[model samples]
Target: MEFRQVSDLNFNISRVTLGTWAIGGWMWGGSDDQLAVGTVIEALEKGITTIDTAPVYGFGKSEKLVGQALQEFGNRDEIQLATKFGLEWDDEGNVQRNSTRERILKEVDDSLRRLQTDYIDIYQVHWPDLDTDFSETAETLQELLDSGKIRAIGVSNFSPEQMDEFQQTAPIHVCQPPYNLFERGIEKDVIPYCKENGITLLTYGALCRGLLSGKMSKDRTFNKGDMRRDADPKFQGETFDKHLEAVEKLKEYADKNFDKKVIHLAVRWILDKGIDSAIWGARKPEQVTFDNAFGWKFSHKQVKGVEEIVETIVEDPVSPAFMAPPE
Candidate 1:
């Protein structure tokens, strides 16, 4: 496993972070606790030291499971517990952006308790709360940093301008943006801003929520609770077929040229794009194979080839905006 250092952080994050949203079982139907625990421990044993989760992910279930896994593994200091806050949920599973000072104040302690850690390595704002002043959120995170409740601050799904406003009060050390083979929206502004500002980029959805995993089939169906069945437009009718076509071509291209799977190519593409890390979502031990994602990269010509394929094939491309919660 490869590691990269983020600004203002004491530890190095794995180049491929373990995303536990699936294990949270919120949007992707349901999850098994034993499987989730096995998955986390397997990833850590395989050298994936950074695990990303959000309180809203399964409404705190993912953090609790990760905590349990870490406890069993018994190596707290070796792992980086990266979790998020600011999105409040209800008993019925409805969520809204709520980054108020009060929300952060309570969420931090709750996350620490669930994660079984006193301090989070990277605590992020899951989304920007349009109603709240950016300073209010930033000030609270600064206090957390000072109090040693969190070692670093991060922001997700934030516009470049919103980050600028938040930075006015506190410096951001890491930024989480949905970035992958299909979701290239952040490459325009967010990626450049992070590079120029010295903030490490830990991009999520390395497989485009299993689209680029190269294991999905047309006849395959998701459960009723699966977010892709409804929340994601790309999984519907013609849009889904178009992406599958691109995936097929990309899969063939990777196997023919690099002798690697599309999953490897997709993740390597992100790392080669200069991203500090890529969040590889997995819910099972077998899905945690990211060691091959490193030690290789797409050639410059191959990168352009990939763009040409996607831009030409997926005429009605979609981003991850549909999954964002209400403001």
Candidate 2:
């Protein structure tokens, strides 16, 4: 469990953060509370000190469960709690971007209550609200930081220009972008911007929502409520097959070269690309295995070889455009 210090933060966060989006059970069908609790405990035991969650994830259910697990673990100060706001949802699960000053103020209090923590280690804007002024959101976060409601401010799914605009009013210590073996969209601008600005990048979807986990199969089916069933185009028809083919080749390469699974390779790939941290999504205790993901990396030549393999296998690669919030 290697740790990296983010700008102006008190704790050195783990390289691998436990992502609770799946445990939220909103898009992945459903989740069991006991299983979620066990998964978090397993993560802490395995040296995962940072947990990334969002208010819209299962409509606060994920944060509540994480709070419960942290209470049982009884080590609030040792763990880094990373959560987000701005994405609002109603009873019908209709979501929209809302990052007004009032919304940010209200959401911080709600997140505190849900997470069972007075000060969030890092609080982020879940998405860019086109309707709201960036300064408005930045000023609100600055106020939160000044009042000690949050230790640091971060942003997710934001472009370099958007971040530049927001930074005029407040500081951004970190950036959360969806990054994985399949989702390389952020590498062009987001990654370079964070690197140049000294903002830590905590990338989510290390396994591409289980596609690179080496467990996906052609015949495997998703439940009705599962986001992969409809929301994710990677799991649909030919794109799914193309991704699976790439995963198969990547898995073979991993096993042959390093005696590691594709999941490990997927995670290591993110880290090797100079990301500050990779968020691993898990819903069960056994799924929290961190041994396979650490202690090794792909060589430069091997990295290019892996890219060649992906190019050879995935003819029509798809972006995760469907997961973006409403404008």
Candidate 3:
């Protein structure tokens, strides 16, 4: 329920952004339209006003559902819509990166129509398209900003070097990267880069695909088509067991120290590390709980303590590298 401001656009985004990737039903088996709308409403009612989605999410289904929810909510101005472009999928659902100028131009209008909004609060490139020149893509986003089609520009899964090249051509107001208690890769560069450059960090995967939810069990199973079954390395064998054990210790620590759960600790850890916002992915309405995570502060010592506990259990932790787009 807490909010943070982006210096560039003065946008007050909620600490918990409603991530609609699962609602898109692209990789997490499937989705229910009714449940999806209810999920958005639940998030908004719980003070999560920002929604992060993408065109390739169910190939526009997520955006359409979000548009429906907005219409039902009846106050478009209250919500901050954050969506992405630069990835295209085929009839068979194969995805590839494509950030050419023409692609961006086409994608924006489609996004507008799907979301039923003329202006997007924040528009981001889903991934870096090596085939396209960074300057060219930057120019296109700048044009969108100048034309009022998009209020701000951001990029996801981009390195510091890529961001430097992107900023040389256009201003970046935010950066989205995969970050959580388990995946600490961004701590090496992306976090510091955004912190120093005045760009807000909207980190996704705050739950580590339900691993940190404190509800996953050793006997749990995933849907046959679920991305966690194949795409995520953390869900495999010994790594999964190690992660679960770490979560158990984390839960105990949270309950003893702060009367919180592992999920709250996972999210608060990110916010405490200076991230502007964290995207919480969910498909069901009841799953959009934001109150428990906000208004809690983690001491530097406590943060270090949690890290040490995780280090003890997860000696060979893995990042969500499989979620990356094909090169």
lDDT of 3 at 205: 94
Each candidate: how many clashes?
A: 0, 0, 0
Model 3 lDDT per residue over 24-66, tens place: 9988988899999999988888888899999998999999999
lDDT of each model, Cα atoms only?
0.91, 0.91, 0.91
Q: Report the lDDT tens digits of candidate 1 across residue range 192-213.
A: 9999999999999989989999
- Candidate 3 TM-score to native: 0.98
RMSD of each: 0.9, 0.9, 0.9
TM-score of each model, in listed order = 0.98, 0.98, 0.98
RMSD of 3: 0.9
Q: What is the lDDT of candidate 3?
A: 0.91
Worst 10 contiguous positions by lDDT, candidate 2 = 312-321
